[model samples]
Target: MTQGRSIRLFLVDGAPNGLLTAEIMNWTGHVLTGPRSKLSELVQRPECGRTGIYFLVGTDPDGDLRPLVYIGESDDVATRLKQHNRPEEKGGKDFWEKVCLVTRKDQNLTKAHVKFLESLLIQNAGAMGRCKLSNGTAHEYIGLPESDRADMAFFMEQIRTVLPVLGLDFLRGIGRPSSNQQPEPFTPTQPETYPLAGAENPRLKMEVKKHNIVAFAQELDGEFVVLEGSLARGEWIDLKHNYRHLYKQLCDEGVLVDDGNGFKTFVRDYGFTSPSPAAAVVAGRAANGRFDWKIEATGQSYADWQDQQVSAAAAQSEEMEPT
Candidate 1:
């Protein structure tokens, strides 16, 4: 079972969108995040002078849904951030609109420690494919002592845990079964099938007979994940629809690859904010995902299944309450 964690968040300026700091109980790591416009104020904070890693995040200028991110580490993050905030003519990056800094409250992080963190973060972010990384080449750092390496690994895990609470999920990988639900062993022979094992959230299938596309998806951790090896329409037919651009972006990113016929295959599991976009991508047109995605076991639509779950939960809650 996963243990519960206590996290404290403080809004520095007492404004929800203003500068903020986050810390976890019994953890030395600290996170400070704010918009680009607050660079002057953010740099003035004492933590900015410490050795740490920082992330610059913003939307892709090309209008892709995935944000553009650049990760860097510095002995003096304040100075480095100042350089990054300069005019583009001075080799500064103008694409990023928000900055998140990760430092330690104890101020024990060293140059070598942050370098290792930066490299590992870059590698994980690249592997996750949740954002478009602005980093050109990830530097290798192998000089840390064995014990320090272990400490840094724990630090990285804390960063991963804290980041999502701050609305930064680029490092969050594809969804997995919840703690109470254990995944069934995967069979290579049945590449297209995902065993449900009577789980509450069953695997859903979306089929477009006209396009000969078959896709599999599941809801995990509140995100709809289109499993790898699922098939989607080779060409997006709804040109004027907003989701067409998303389909094109996925194709460009190689998440969807041509299968040599009239369909594209998902190279890896990809998470979407909701099922509508997932359905739209697989069907090659705008689709009502709640109606289109059906439970493989009972042929119930996602909407119906979701409704049943909600009703059951409400009834259970009422039964548990005092008269």
Candidate 2:
């Protein structure tokens, strides 16, 4: 089981949407994030003058599944940020709408340290495929001492931990499930047990025989994950719905690629907020996920299986209540 973490978030302007700071317990790294409209306020903060890596986040004009990001490092982040905030005609970036700065509380990071961090961040972001990076080329920096490299690696892990809590999840990679695994059935007696723990969840399948589509998915940590190697329709057939856009985005990101047949294959496991979108992508049209996804072993509809769990939990609760 993963251990719990405590994170502290401070809203600078006393507004949820305004400038905010985040820090994890026992971590030396600090994070400050805010919208582009608050750029002046963010740069004025003392942390901006320290050496650090920063991220520029914005929507992708190409309608990709992921947000667009530009990673960079600077000895004086304020100066670099000011330059980026300039008019586009002045060689400034206009796409970014939010900024997140990662710096150290001890203020001991050097130029080489941040450069090395920037390089790794870019590489990892590309590997995660959760965002479209705007940077042209990633320059490797190997000047850091071995000890310093170890420290930076730990610092990078802290960054990864804190960013997701701050609503930045592009750094998180898709979790791969073990092959041919079947999740244990949810036991109603264990009310406190997490339903989506480990690889115990059932493998669900969505088959559209007419279109030759067959997709496999599982519920993990509350997200519906379409597994790698699942087959989907090559083209979106429903133009009336917005899920077609998501389908197109997945294709553009290479999450779905042509199999040389009439179908598209999942290059990697991808998680959706829920099963409906996953079903929509697989079927090439709008679909009701609860009815569409079925337990591969029992052929039970997802809705029926989920309803059974809920009913069992309720019965368990009633039995536990005072007679």
Measured against the true structure, the TM-scores of the candidates, in listed sequence, are 0.92, 0.89
In angstroms, how far off is 162's CA in candidate 2? 1.2
Q: Judged by lDDT against the true structure, how good is candidate 2? A: 0.86
Predicted candidate 2 versus true structure: per-residue lDDT over 20-77, tens digit per residue: 9999999889999999999989999999999999999999877675789999999999
Q: Cα lDDT of all candidates, in order?
A: 0.87, 0.86
Give the Å error, residue 23, model 2: 0.6
Residue 53 accuracy (lDDT) in model 2: 97
Compared with the true structure, what per-residue lDDT tens digits does model 1 show for residues 127-210? Answer: 777889999878878899989988987898789789999999987656653445553422212212223323576889999987
Question: Which predicted model would earn the best lDDT?
Answer: 1
Q: Which ten residues in a row have the lowest lDDT in candidate 2?
A: 185-194
lDDT of 2 at 311: 95
The candidate scoring highest on TM-score is: 1
* Runs in model 2 lying further than 4 Å from the true structure: 179-200, 311-323
